[model samples]
Target: MAVHSSDYPFSAFPSPLTTSPKVPNPESQTPSPAAAAAAAHGGSAKKRKSGLIECQEPQGGGNSAGESSLDLISWLPDEVLGTVISLLPTKDGARTQAVSRRWRPLWRAAPLNLGASSDLTDQDQKRLVFVSKILSDHPGPARRFSLPCMRLRDRYAKINGWLRSQTLTGLEEIQFGYEIEDPLLHYPLPPSALRFAPTLRIAYFGYCDFPREMAPLLKFPCLKQLNLCGVIVLEDVLHSLLCGCPVLESLLLEGNVGVGCLRINSPTLRSIGISVSCYGTRVENPILLQDLIIEDAPCLERLLPLYPIRGPLTIRVVRAPKLEISGWLSDSITKLHIGTTVFQKMIALSLTTSMRSTVKVLALDTFGPNLDSVVDFLKCFPCLQKLYIKADLQKSRKNKWSYNPLDPIECLESHLRQVVVMKYWGMRPDVDFAKFFVLNAKVLKKMVFGCINNCNDNWMANQHRRLQLDNKASQGVEFKFRRGSCSISLTHSRHKQDDPFDSHIFADDA
Candidate 1:
């Protein structure tokens, strides 16, 4: 249950072990600045713990400014320089004030960011004392604040004081979680938590319980993204929270959510990611997210199941007119309902969705080589253009993948343009599975096989013979092969990668 750098949504900030963000040398970044900062890193015990203060001036003294001699960074426009300092770590950002008279006012004028980690010190008392000092020093209009993981039951008063700081009036993002030791972890959701809700754009809460009674009192007009990673809230409270965030675009309900079902009815919601992750635990019977019904989400584009859940989770899509998913769909879903069509147990019982053109890009995580399901899905999504399949390397059914030439798939014949398969171990079933596409897909332009094992000249020739590439259906098809496998890493990072579900995370060695 311990928190690591990865646990934090924005891994760049608030890490006790992290160094100050690398500041550039005016024109372009060289390796020199980072090395210099590393060599000269020194500050208060708190700042030293966070590995900050490259500007490393004494706490509040500017008379000894070595920076006064070579002042290239200070030449930047006040607006530009202030922004640069604002993005630095709290200790580093605060340290810049001591560099020179030019830098002193800049730190106070720039929007503030305050971050504390549980590991910042051996005791929360010492960390709170340092945080209290920063609160009293900074003036106003804070940008983001991340409250370190702590037991809310004991430190709620301290958190209240921090939230009540005059500096955080225009706060944009805030994150907090309750320590498992809190006996009253769920009840009386901190009243000061929503002090700047109107201005908040992103909120991440963990291990807390939402009170349905207080839902009517909430309104987050500017909230765009809300992530309640590990929490327990009643079904109505969940819907009520969505109602309050009238403009929320991205919603993630991850980590063994204790809700009977999640029914979304939002006009502005764009994407939803759900996962039941019990990576390390000994809960006798943990609650899991059950049914996900899109009662009405006209603007919704993507429905992502980020982590593979062990239990059944039915997804009934009543209305998601613009949904375009890539690689987040597979057998993990107990049942899938796209419009009027029903896809259960990898069989298409009906093909009645009028929004057949909605799914242009799809990525499927087949537990194993389940070709029939892929074919069935093609029937459901006939207008798909890009298809990415990550299948298990285990031996599939002995029967060959059979699809009638007389009965054509719409996407394979006319629409489907690219096909990429990851973890392609060239066993007997793997050959049968891939050769079918090579022999049939008439409009397929590219076929990429990400093989698990490395191949030599002789091995490549043997596999080429098995797939019968010489007699392929598409004359202009470009086939490629590469070693290693890939799967999407669902870890959230607001700064580096905006979309958690994108294929940007996949690489040769991943």
Candidate 2:
């Protein structure tokens, strides 16, 4: 589960440490007869040296018994020792109490991580009672107290009273699961209970509701990580709670009830990850994050928009210097979806010579119409390298493939090296276009065409054949036309889904 240090007991040592120690060097040239005799009586020699010896004494601090004891528990850190004990079956952990006095205290006080099947059975209840009695008699804060699948409602009052009185002063973790029919009665935590906890770091609230003042009840100032999944909170309540958690750096929200623009601003905050269903009516102002996450943060790198774009979305990026789109560009971006329409707009802009070269990557679902016109528009991008496109081979109502290969992108041979074609249903028109790209692209390294379905065996076969022919050619250019599975399939066995906006919809302007 948790990776521990490999050095083990050797980690406790200074200077000399190894999994296997080297044998001591041979004695001086003139070996003492006493040293030879000492080697012979191996079993009896070690017992002669015992108790605290001075620092300079040769055999003083090194004892076989102490070394053996330390070696057994070498890898066990104080942090994970509780985990190892919790993972043990109840009987096994309890049996360890007699081994040593040091174990007896931790076995009782450490937060127990009982397995899923560790609920109290009839005999187990008796044993647990005896164990609990023994632990209660010897008192201190338990580092951990874990019980899972426990039907402890009948003893809730008693357990709660004991927990309150005990006041786990040093408890770092407390994992307890209860399966009760009705919701447990709300119990207010005493001031002493909250104040006593100095090292309490993490807590999981599953199927549990926090009081209105859960922020104060929890010493929010000390927490660095907070995970809220499947928890109920009023609108803006979570945001308020997080604002109070000054030291909180990481926040994960999954399947939360109240969903809206999550406003978060904390200097200590470095990473944030959120996924929510955005199929419903769009919120007016979903999120307004500032200072904490700006344009230039190599640390805060991921922007996961889990929800679908519900309405006309416009991201007014003031100055996101390092922002780059990696996966699945939004379909609702009007300019990206309106392939030919965007070309027409660009054509118009090119006429006035006013179009800026700010846009870098231009990915088209269909590169059918106005190729010449769009190329005229993209002439502004002097540093363009990648051109991603998906073309519809079927003849549209207006005309066949009207885009000529020689006019626009022909000049971009030096700038564009890779052209990715999505939804490549093996059609003659698409193949013919692929042939044109293979012939014209001077700096092209790869032309990736993807098949739509697994059952499209014929398409895959033809693609393979085309790839082979290109690979073994003599006069043709040295560009690769790699074919594989389809990136996205549109063969729904029904009518093709048409977007409300035609091609050439400017996404950034949305």
Candidate 3:
């Protein structure tokens, strides 16, 4: 075959050309044996020189065979690849299905890194399918799976199947957030799925519903931590479900879904955090707390009784050692929390925990009802060190002291070391508490008056100015006011339409 120069022009050479196979051009003058043999195979070389030689096309990307043989995700270095794959929204990632069979399975192999975010777009479906398929085909269990904003019933069914399929492999963590439309049909966890998910350690459910039966809980004996946010659960079913999980250590419940008096009976419970909000209508139903019977949790260490119903919190923690709580408090117990309603519940706390010796940190909303109650709380915690009074003096509750109000708790002035007056406007009571601290606490180191609301009045500003100056003048009782720590905005009131400043206002999480 006398191959001519016109037979294969230079234009036919591969774009971004490479001469690797050592094929001699037949157009050369010498009839070398190699050139003749190469010419014989030049047809294959020409096909190779055409666009077919590209490992990956500039526009189309991976070729069919390359796509079939190469696992796109597998070609990705294990550590760096997961990061790259995670960027593709589930929907786009699942489009790997069209890439090749190898990549189809590779997309499924990427680790499920679910974050706690509410943002979900239509593109998330592809990535979700990739994750679902991977979990389905995976030989073992998925350690972490986050399905946020999962709304469809079919998706739930597939997820339920995926979870069941992975049961023997041991799922470590599962987070599911979905809006429940038809509770019975959409949110059913089969008995097999539940029983097999014994390896689950942490589970978070958002805007979900648990049926009255709660038969699925019998299988969750290993569940240690559970977070239920924006969930409406039946009262009777809640108690039964909680009691069934003997190993439950930490529990968090937020928002109101009609949960009355929570009677927790878990023996292994170490910490309990609750934030229950009560936003009522015109009709006032008595704020009822799900009764928290303390007799059950013997090993309980930290108890956070957050915005419970407007009632006395009766946690018989005479048994548990340490308690850490926050939010609106009733006087039935004396502890650390924000707001003054704790003073209302003060009378109950006085009679209950009289034996308690030390309260190291105390944050008060503002003195309320009885100065004697304040004295009572201080007296009970004789070894108190840090006292934080987060009071809005402009919103102070009025009460006429019957006895010499300042005399009994005069010891507080001497014993307390650190006293913080938050939202201070340098009112008489504010000055009085500050002056009392200056005169009493002999070893007091720092006295901070945080004035969130700016006091333009010269006299009010000078009062704090003088206190700081006078403290410097005397034995140098260090006094300072750090600005911008809190907002000066007026809070909305439920009582008066004209009066925006309602001093009696107590935040639900007070």
Candidate 4:
């Protein structure tokens, strides 16, 4: 991310240039009146001629001061000037052309990062014309071009025309998204523009449609990230586009239809995010997505599905040993929806090896009817520290604690330190669960009760009073109460190491 002036050189200026004139020896030459004044004013004489001074004394002691001298910034090296102009906004950078003739070529020669929106100005047509003019005037390849959150329905042809004229061989990133005018409309992308851009590394398109006819020829050999949000394309066309990207590392698809199933077979892919919208009102049809098959992705780390799959949704991972952090344990498993079969498998996996203790933090949606099943699951992870219980009030109201008080869980007595019980309404089961941890967890340092519904000040006070009556095993346990629900931590404080899978969860959770 570091930017250096040497990286962006001016093609027209081959040598370094400066505006400051060489200074004469102070002892040999008599100081000018301006230099004398500067010396009297506590400024160096050479700083006056270098355009560092803002104003000079009137020639004959007149009342008015003389106009400011030429800016020394114009004399800066082309590389420095290019870096300065590149930081300016598109409109402000264009206006710098009027500053001087030297500045005119600097804007064109600098790496072009054009970003415009219709919301910036009242007249949409004028904005479009201004963007078109900039694109026409600058024929070089751009570094980044972004036109996000703009209304492009009427100006689709104009946008396509502007894109067609661009030489995007060196373009690194491009983002185009339509405004919230019409939700279902899909703007067609220029096929020629995409086909010619061989150096594109990141591309994001919203409310757009891909050309089916050019799917076979679509190839972005250097593309590492591709995001298609609210885009419409055929199943085969989507597959063909994915097949063409040989080294893609991240792929995100949200609200995309016409593709029932996705099969990713990339060797370099590391992250994937998918969110699908059901087709119709009938639950039977339910977007018949069969399986998301991932194969040969040894570096794969993150897999996220935004919504819960309603139909037969299966995820099959092949040849990805790193998918699980250690053995069958995953350090990034924040939220899990486990059934009886999967729960049994976890138990078997934990017992097979002593090195597979990766589940340090766990969040449960519901404790289920059997408390022993939950206790048995926790016994597998010997390094368990923090526990989150998102209690379903209705199910918890009917369930009862079935664990024997004589035998305490190993984690509760030794490893467990922090506990959070969310959606607490002082129900009998909820109070019992909270009391169990307070009384048994010898190492517990913090316990939080998050009240999300049906609990007011008096209710919280009463619950707090009841919980304090039980003598806690850990003398330093501090209790806290908040007004919101608990959120699953994708990365916990215990595990500060970077997890590649953490970035893909937001796309899936959204």
Q: Could you tell me the C-alpha RMSD of candidate 3 in Å?
A: 16.8
- lDDT of every predicted structure (CA atoms): 0.68, 0.39, 0.47, 0.56
The regions of model 1 sitting more than 4 angstroms off are 1-77, 118-126, 151-153, 179-189, 277-286, 310-312, 393-406, 494-510
TM-score of 2: 0.44
Q: After superposition, how far is residue 257 of candidate 1 from its true place, in Å?
A: 3.3
Clashes of each: 1, 16, 21, 1
Top TM-score model: 1
C-alpha RMSD (angstroms) for model 1: 8.7
Give the distance in Å from residue 455's predicted Cα in candidate 4 to where it truly belongs: 7.7
Give the worst 10-residue stretch by lDDT in candidate 1: 9-18
Where is model 2 more than 4 Å wrong at Cα?
Answer: 1-167, 174-198, 216-218, 277-299, 305-459, 465-510
Give candidate 1's error at residue 18 in angstroms. Answer: 27
> Cα RMSDs of all predictions?
8.7, 15.2, 16.8, 12.4
Error of 2 at 324 (Å): 8.6
Global Cα lDDT for candidate 3: 0.47
